[model samples]
Target: MLTPGDGGAGPAVPVGTRGPTVQTLATGEVFAALDASPRGLASADAAARRDRFGPNELPPAGRRGLWQDLVGQFTDLFAVVLLVASAITFLAYGLQKPQDVGTLQLAVAILGVVVLNAAIGFAQEYSAERTAESLQAMVPHTCRVLRDGERRELPARELVPGDVVVLEAGDAVPADCRLVEAHEVSVNNAALTGESDAVGRTGDPVAAGPVLQARNCVFMGTDVVAGAAKAVVFATGAATEFGGIFRLAAAAPRQKTPLQRQVASMARRVAGTALAIGAALFAVRVPAGQSFVETFVFALGVMVALVPEGLPATLSVSLAIGVRRMARRHALVKQLLAVEALGSTTVVCTDKTGTLTQAEMTVVQVWAGGAPHAVSGVGYAPEGDVANPQPVRGLLRAAALCCNARLVPPSDRQGWRVLGDTTEGALLVAAAKAGLDRVTEEAAAPRVAEYPFDSVRKLMSTVHGDTADGYHAYVKGAPQELLARSTSIDWGGERRPLTEELRAAVTAANDELASQGLRVLAAAWRPVSDSRPVQDEVESELTLLGLVGMLDPPRPEVSDAVAACRRARIRIIMVTGDHPLTAEAVARRVGIVSRPAPTVVTGARLDALDDKDLDTLLAAPGELLLCRVSPEHKMRVVTALQRRGEVVAVTGDGANDAPALKHADIGVAMGASGTDVAREAAVIVLLDDSFASIAAAVKLGRSVYQNIRKFLVYVFSSNIG
Candidate 1:
């Protein structure tokens, strides 16, 4: 846990115009003047640190010393029996005798191995402190802040409450603050909240605090996804960042995973039984007038026979092997315990945005007039042939010209890549599928004008010059917005009258596409007056294009991954924040839910359920998806699942996911796209971030668990003999 001493408030440096300034976050109260003051803010920072840390705040309890730590780590029954036997052998029959030399050397070897095991285990467990340090490294060492109307670079640690900080794209927030002003700013609070897309920021004071979006609030440790703004620092360091949870989390002793706890319990029982047998032997033989030496040797032999000294070593080796195997399969194991933990996982909570679906979105559905056109393929690959190729050149031209993102050829033509948002990329791919060769055709007919896509409008417009005729504008976005503006529809068969009835039919088609787990995008276009630029006069869409459908499409190997979990008796629960329909659709595709009446638990309903209902609901098969669940709800679900003797592994990559990630027996996070905070908290990180990777990880985990079990069995049998 961090105190003010560790990268907290230090001496403040003077900031020139556009420099750091201190003011209250909500009230705009000036805690310290902005003009020409260096020590002034420093004094305030010192005071804040004192108030936060305080003299009354106690330090964590000191840990055992190296020797004591080793001994304490091996507090298992097996170790205790060995220690007792060694003491008896030394006291009774001296180690100097020839016969005793063999026994003594063996005893010495056992002690050496035991101490080595303890040392290694303790070292590995304590290495997580370095992970914390690594996390702290993610924070920018220095930040440019506005003080006395001048911008100056100062250590980010010096930032105190109420300091106004300038933000730009890619800058990790220096401290937590409420936005005083913003212009087209959006923060990716995915680190703090699990929301996938960037949240739009505004200067307006949040009217409803209940719905806590990072829109108006700039939080520490969160990066600006796009745009720029100024915000007053309300919190800093541990207090400002994720509500000082890091400190609490770091200080909290790393609890043994449920499997570890169970193994430890079993090990202790085995050790106890061995000791009891040795004690009984000593008691029975000693009273028969046998010498202390004879009785001691007899007991010592019995103890050695029962104690499984190599069990810990064998378990460690198995885990190491499992980790290596997983790494070979592209799933890096951060914590060794995670390998075993995956074997015992009962529920796997995964994120929807990037984990289950490709992070890159594409236009899957095109709503043109009264017709629905399904776009083929998932992601940026342009190899897949369109299911229904449209022969009309104008419709293809509209889709190509109307989109913002363009497909670029990689080094190889077969390896096509996109240079835009997943949604826009999807459109480009769809345009390509429509037989509009964007790379060659767009070059020939060049884009004359274009308007970038924005959230508020939710549509992108582009005009192409020299496209057979004069100019055409293709528009793709929300169906409701496009339908409201459209004047007519082209029903491939004929130019049909687009009435309210027809519009509802189009809407239903889009809904049907969505119900099947395809993200549907409505595409429309108009032949506008080429005299004016495309942006100025692009609002009136004359034709409604066909609807396009998209799905992340399941990983090819996920089916087998799910089947493997089933074979191991692990129940797979997909917990996500996606719509129930969408999540259910994906689950069904992955073979998680085959039945039609699959039970789905929503976040709101979960909150209302008592423990009893929650427990009963978990056992119900066919219900694999929990949709729109809050972080707290996830924690509850994980805990409840665990209470029912099911091992839970939660996979997530957002700040809201932190609590459940910490609560679960093992937490897995996406390595590539996951936020640093999420990775820091998770036990395992999926480097490839594929469900297939997780499946492979689970297999490795199971192998590790089996090896541990095998060692236990071997040790027990050898001892009994």
Candidate 2:
């Protein structure tokens, strides 16, 4: 069994101890095992646990030293052949023709070629390693925990088993733990399990099964999607599921790129043919009365001449040129081989957000006071307008008031940017489009209190009050949730009872907007006479304010880019951590799936299939859309496609995407929004996060490969002459 101390400094617990599987143990039993209480361990106890458990981080796998990499550069087949020929020539010259320096010159020339190639290779590899190290520093490093019965933020690496950690929305879990108290807590376990759907947690114990399936346990590396919980850490570092997978992925050998394999094969064949020809020449000359030493030296000279001494340098230069060209087009190529690999990509597994579509959220449609209106423009620029603004002004106003996101005006080369949630930012932008100035509005009726949004409640309410109107609560959330809380609707500038027929009509409108791949949010307001009423009471009897339809619309250039991929015989498959319907809708809009009914697979459905089933699905002859997939699922999909002899390129922009990014033949990361870990893992970074740039990169990749082959032919032909 894996133990907390297996790879670190933790003290060994008793044999057959179930401390790590604290989910199965009762709350009192867990506290007993840890020698702690509900309040938490004392600072002194925490210090002892830290020494016992070591740092709460996965140990990095041992990497090859610079010396080893430098040595590897001169160890290829061609290099070995040249070394052997130089050695033989040196021996023959020393033994039979010490005074003559021709053979010595030849030997010196061959050694120079070897040393030059090794130096160039070493420099590139060292630079790449440094780049990766820099990128890893971008991930968040701190976590919140309770020590000495006081909640405080601490470096994640300081966490140890038995420590009590507090988890909230947007926080990455610091270590594996058993939930002591949970309130509507939902975790996105995509990094560990390859499932993008958020799983709810509870303090209740679960039956024995997969640890991930347990409702009472949360693992390290997963992010909290909503709610808050207090959990007792049972395992840290390599003992956690995240660390295990990290170790597994690290241990898996990196597959050689197609270009590398081909080059190796060509080098071996050239070396073999040169050796055979030299041997034949030696035999024929020696039998014809020539001295053995002279004949041998002559043969070695011939073999040395056949070796393309500048081939490595030329290949590097060609790839460097391609890299420079790609960089100008907004595609930064990190590795020389990746440039070649991109050309051979038969399938591009791309993420939807920030790659095919602009990552910015925008409000495109609005339904308020029984009227439908369209909001012009895209992104968070806040320069758009609604044709019929008066009817929807009330709804837009409530959405803006209920929002927490702040819109910052353009500054320092950046356009208008959102300071909080993108969804909330879109709402604020929509209100701006309807001529609602946030500054003026907030000044008139400042926010007095707020009932923060929670995943369980599916709504966020803010109490805004002034002397004139007393107090009013503005609420916004999922349309259905708001509809349920509301008792009346504002129609045609008048309030009316929410009848069954009207409710159905509102539901139909929401469905219609959702069907078009828009995210729908409803807004409502209530009159709260009490300045500080209970949150539950404040939410009662809300007046419905209709719905807002928003979407991260596909980039205008993407459709043409998708068409280009088709022309190049490259298949585009979208794999995202989004709803299946949304994924399909975006896929259609971007021209990825031409057929009206394409195969749409969800992560839940993917978990049920075996490797064979996945292979079968991949073998089907059309574009496939994978929704709500985790990093592991993406890696598996890429592996399956590769197993079938397809060259795969994957694009992503999160820390969770690092694994799949490293696993693919060519990984593309978004420069603007991608985490450092992802950028470090990827071979290419798109500065503008554009799909069109990827197509342009593919074109350049193909050209680079062709140019290398052309250079090889020219060098070999010249050597023969």
* Cα RMSD for candidates in order: 6.6, 4.2
Candidate 2, lDDT over the whole model: 0.79
lDDT of 2 by residue, 91-125 (tens): 76676665468767877877777787667656655
Can you give the TM-score per candidate against the true fold?
0.77, 0.85
User: lDDT (CA) for every model shown?
Assistant: 0.64, 0.79
Candidate 1, residues 312-417, lDDT tens digits: the string is 6666667767767887776656566678888877777666656666655555555454455556676677755554566334455566666545566665323455
Give the poorly placed runs of model 1, Cα more than 4 Å off. 1-99, 115-177, 180-189, 197-199, 218-233, 240-253, 365-377, 380-422, 432-474, 490-505, 527-538, 551-556, 622-624
In TM-score terms, candidate 1 sits at 0.77
